[model samples]
Target: MKLNVAALLALSVPCFAQQDPNAVEAGRLVFRMSCAGCHGLHATGGRGGPDLTRGTYSTGDADKDLFSVISNGVPGTEMPSFRGALEDANISRLVAYVRSLSHAGAVPVKGDRTAGEKLFWGKGSCGQCHRVGMRGTAIGPDLTRAGKQRSLAYLRESVVAPDADLTPGYATIVVVTRDGAKITGVEKGFDNFSARLIDLSGRYYSFLKDDVKSMEREYRSVMPSNYGRMFSANDLDDLLAYLASLGGER
Candidate 1:
C-alpha cells in the first residue's frame, strides 16, 4: 500500500533536536530497547528496516515525519506506533539520534573523495549521461544523492554492469525518424501521441509517435558498461567513495 506522505509531511515538526545533550543519549538507549530489533544494533538497518544512516526515507524525512512515523506508525507497513508506549518527548530524542547518524562526523569514508570526483567528471564522462547537482545531462540517473540512497555494493554493481538493474522512470528509447534520422537516448516521457528523449549530450529530442518511422523501447541502460575495466580497481573504489559522499555532508 502507498503511504500518505502528503499527510505525513503536513504533520507538526518535533523539537527534540533542540533538547539537552542527555536527550540524544536517552534516545540512543530508547532505540536499543525499542527499535534495535528490526533497525539493527547500530541503526545500520536489517531485514525489514532501512538504513537510517543513508538518510533516505520512503515516508518523509522531515522532523515532523520522523516524529509521526514513530508516534503513529505507517498505515500499510510493519512499522508500528509508539504513541502508547512512549511519550512525545521521547520520540523527539529518537529523531535527534536518527538524524545524527547521517552526519559526516559520524560516518567516515576510507576512499579518497577528491580523486573520485575527478574520475567521475574526467575519464568517466559520467556528466555526459548522468546529472550531478545542477550540471550534467539527464540521459541517465541523477547521482546527486546517490551516496545517500544507494549502498556501496549496489553502486559497484551499477558501474560494473550498467544494464544489470534499471531504475524506474529511466528506460532507454530508440527513435527512427521518417527522414531516416536515427536517434538513441534515455526516455523521459512518452505516450501513443509523442515521446521525449534526452540524448547522450544532454540534448532533448521530442517527436510525435506518428511522425517517426518507428520507435522502440530498449531495456538496456544508456550508461557505459565498461567502467569495471576502464578504471583501475583503486580508481573505481575512489570514484564510488566520492559518488557515495555527494549528499552526505549536509
Candidate 2:
C-alpha cells in the first residue's frame, strides 16, 4: 500500500521541533541526501534495511541507544558506523528524525476473525497438529499464546515455510522397532542400541536397535505448507491478527 509520507513527516516534525529545530532540519536534509537512497524516500525501508515504521526499535528507545548503534554500527553485518564522518550533534539529529518516525498508535490491518476461524478448523486443517485456545490435538505446541511470543514476520515465514525454524521440542521423526514396526513421533533420543519416540498421544515409545528396521528422520516440517495459496492476503492477515490477539489474556 502507498503511504502518505508527507502527512507522516508533517505529523512527526513538530515533535522534533520542540527538541531542536536546527538539528531536525539538518537531519531531514542529511536523510534526504544520504539515507534516502537506502532507506527509501520516506525512511520506511528499502532493499538494504528493514522497515523502520513497523519495527520495534522506535518506541521507548533512548537517544544514547540510537547514537551507540549508529556510531558503532552492527558487527558482522553490512551496516557501517558513522562515528568518524558524522558529528555527535548531527548524529543526534538523525536519531531524532528516526525517533520521530516511531508511531506506536499506527493502525493495523483489519482482519476477519470469523472467516479465519472457519479456515483454521475446516479447509486449513491446522488443528491436526497445532492447538488454539484448548481446541484441537496437541501434536505440536499450543499456539494460543504464540502471537505474544512471536513477531508478525515470524508468523508469516512460519506459515509460508513450516520447516524454516523447527522449535526445539517439535521436530518430527520416524522410528523403526526391533520387530520391523515403524513408528513416527517427536524425537526424544537416538543411539545405536535404541531410539525414543513421542507420539501425538504423548506416549513415549522406545525401540530396540536389533529388532528395528531402518529409522528415518525428516528435517521438513509436519505443518502443511499450502497456507499461502489457500488463504487470500487479507485472509492471511486476518488469521495472523487473530493469532496475534490470542495472547495477553493472562
Candidate 3:
C-alpha cells in the first residue's frame, strides 16, 4: 500500500522528547550543520534562501508538515531532502530549533494600517527608494511582499534604523574611475570580474575592476536613519502595521 507522508511523519512524533530538554541545543547543532548556510547562520536570510524564521514558507509551520518537508524537501526549490542526510533523531531536534526562531525576536506592532499607508506615501517619503504594488521607485528593496516574507521585527528595525541590516547586494558604495571621476551608488551587483551600481537618481553604472581608480564600500545606508526621531511612537507603530499588511493573503 502507498504510504502517506503525514502518517509516516506522525509515527516519528512520539520519538521526540516531550520536554525536549536537549531539543533546542541539538536542533541548533542540526541547523548549523545542515541548514544554516543557505537559510543564514541566524536564519535571518541568505542569498539562496528566504528568511526561514519568518514568512509563509512552502513547508507549513505544523510539526508533521515541517518534518515531511525537511525529510522530503520542497519541490522546485533549492531546499533538498535531508531524509538520508540526517538521522531521524537529529531531524526532530532540527525541527525544535527552527520552531524556536519564531519567538526569538517578536515584533510588537500595534496601530492603524490605514493611516500608516498615508504616512508611507505622503509624509514618510518611503516611496522614493522602495516599491510597493508597482507604485514606487526601485532604488531600494521592494515592500510589495515584505510583510509576507519579513517578520514585524525586521520591518521595524529597517525603518527606524535603516543601516542596521543592509540587505545583501544593496550596500552603498563609492567608486572612483581611473579618470579621477568619483561616482557613488548602492551596489546592485558584484562578481569577481565586475560590479554594478545604481544611484539614487535611478542611474545605473557597471565597471570593470581594471577600469576603476578605487572602490570604497560605505557601511552606512543611503536611506535616512532618523525615522525613529522623526516619527512619534504611535506613528512608527502605525507605519509598521501598514507595511506588515502589504503582503500575505491579499
Q: Name the candidate that leads on TM-score.
A: 3
Q: Which stretches of candidate 3 lie over 4 Å from their true place?
A: 1-61, 72-81, 93-108, 176-182, 190-195, 208-214, 246-250
Query: Residue 134, candidate 1: how far off, in angstroms?
Result: 3.3
Over 31-120, each residue of candidate 1 has an lDDT whose tens digit, in order, gives 999998867778875444545776655567887888888999866555788998986777887988888787735444567989999998
TM-score of each: 0.61, 0.54, 0.65
Count of residue pairs whose backbone atoms collide, per candidate: 0, 3, 0
lDDT of each: 0.76, 0.66, 0.76
Per-residue lDDT tens digits for candidate 2, residues 6-98, read 553444443223365555556667678766765666665543443444434522367677667778876654457788887666677787777
Model 1 off-target regions past 4 Å? 1-50, 53-108, 248-250
In candidate 2, stretches whose alpha carbon ends up further than 4 angstroms from where it belongs are: 1-101, 104-107, 188-194, 200-204, 208-211, 248-250
RMSD of candidate 1 to true structure, Å: 9.6
- TM-score computed on alpha carbons, candidate 3: 0.65
What digit string (tens of lDDT, one per residue) describes model 3 on residues 1-250? 3434344434444455435555666677678878878777877655455566653455576877777888998666567899898877767877777778777873345889998999999999999888898788998887887765565667788888888878767888788898898888888876666778899888999988888887766777889899999999999888988987876344
Better structure of 1 and 2 per TM-score: 1
Clash pairs, model 1 backbone: none
The alpha-carbon lDDT assigned to residue 228 of candidate 3 equals: 95
